[model samples]
Target: MKFPAPLVRLWHRLGSPRWFFETTAPWLPWLLGLGVALLGAGAFWGLALAPADYLQGNSFRIIYVHVPSAILAQSCYMLMGSCGVVLLVWRMKLADMVLEAAAPIGASFTALALATGAVWGKPTWGTWWAWDARVTSMLILLFLYLGIMGLRQALQRPEAAGRACAILAIVGLVNIPIIKYSVDWWLTLHQPSTFKLTEKPAMPPSMWIPLLLSVLGFYALFIWSVLQSTRVVVLERERRTQWVQNFVAAEGSKA
Candidate 1:
């Protein structure tokens, strides 16, 4: 089937490693700067400026980090799954690179979410671990990420590795909804979200504002990390190409 003109153009543009690398290179520093600034500001405001919870007290501050990390972790998996679909259906090289680059980052964020959750739990729930629906699903998500990374490493051929990882990523998409609604669907120790798009947040503006900043900052950081890693992947994968060789030589000359 024929795609719309704009989508077709976008697909081709994204598939070209050289174009992607060059296009994103100039934006990297700006992206990093914005990410750092937002994150720093959010940290300060959330940890210091936002009033403590009447019930949870100072412990509520952990949400500034935990919520953002959890949100980003789920988003990263969705991103990888989307790339997996593109790689499988369209056989796009850039899609494969994106999927590969995203796995470890997703894993890191998932791990952070779990770690922070455990830390928060120690105070709130009086335990470090629980097999609650949300926590269990999130743990499964982390394992899925590790599985994809491991599958790619185990495969010898690039195409084989990409296909294997893509399949796993696609299958793992099921867990996203589970993670999101686990609290509603099952009796769990984890609390429901304080902020919802369709409704006013349970939190006051001062608290939710910093949480919003944290979310945006985490997303920016995720984008920056993915772009940086994708650039390196592109270079290594395309090292045999004349463009990459010339690019390397140009850099070497500068050094």
Candidate 2:
């Protein structure tokens, strides 16, 4: 199957470490600024302006943070899984760099989700922890992230470590669906998805609007974080190369 010329060019460029670094460098500050602005707006709106939930009251406002974190957690893993496939099949260096860069960020997001979920749960469920399917699966997701990082560091050879971590990432892709469907598949304290693309949101625009902003903000920040991390990995791995040496010299001169 033939892909479009533009898409093919994009795919190849994305695989190039030098191209990736140079292309993304100018966008980092913009992305960071936009993410911060949107997140701040959404947080203030949700915490102070949005109406309280009749049942959960002010506590439900935490969804602004919790939902975005959980969504990014899964989304980041999916990205790693895609990179894993690319690394295994095409042996793209950028993919390996991405795997190294994104694992810790993904894990941090997962931890934040779990922590916020616990805080939200205390008032709603009257417990800080539970063995509920969705919660348990999310915990497993965190471990999966940790396991991938550990495996990568454990191997003596960089090539072997990248291959092993890629395989593990591919294997762990199965858990994403389980996490998504757990609330529906079994009885759990967790509620069904609050927003759906096909269906209208159960909450009013005043409520969902801030959530939308927060989700977009989280995504922007996630991209910025991953790109920044990947750039560091690229520099570290390519330090001996002329391009990297020149790049470092240029940066040092600016400093």
Which residue runs does candidate 2 get wrong by more than 4 Å? 178-201
For model 2, the run of ten residues with the poorest summed lDDT: 192-201
Candidate 2, overall lDDT?
Answer: 0.88
lDDT scores for all predictions?
0.87, 0.88
Q: Write the per-residue lDDT of candidate 2 for residues 35-55, one digit (tens) a residue.
A: 999999999999999999876
Clashes of each: 0, 0
Assess the local accuracy of residue 48 in candidate 2 as a C-alpha lDDT between 0 and 100.
95
User: In model 1, how large is the Cα lDDT of residue 57?
Assistant: 80
- True-structure lDDT of candidate 1: 0.87
Residue pairs whose backbone atoms clash in candidate 2: none
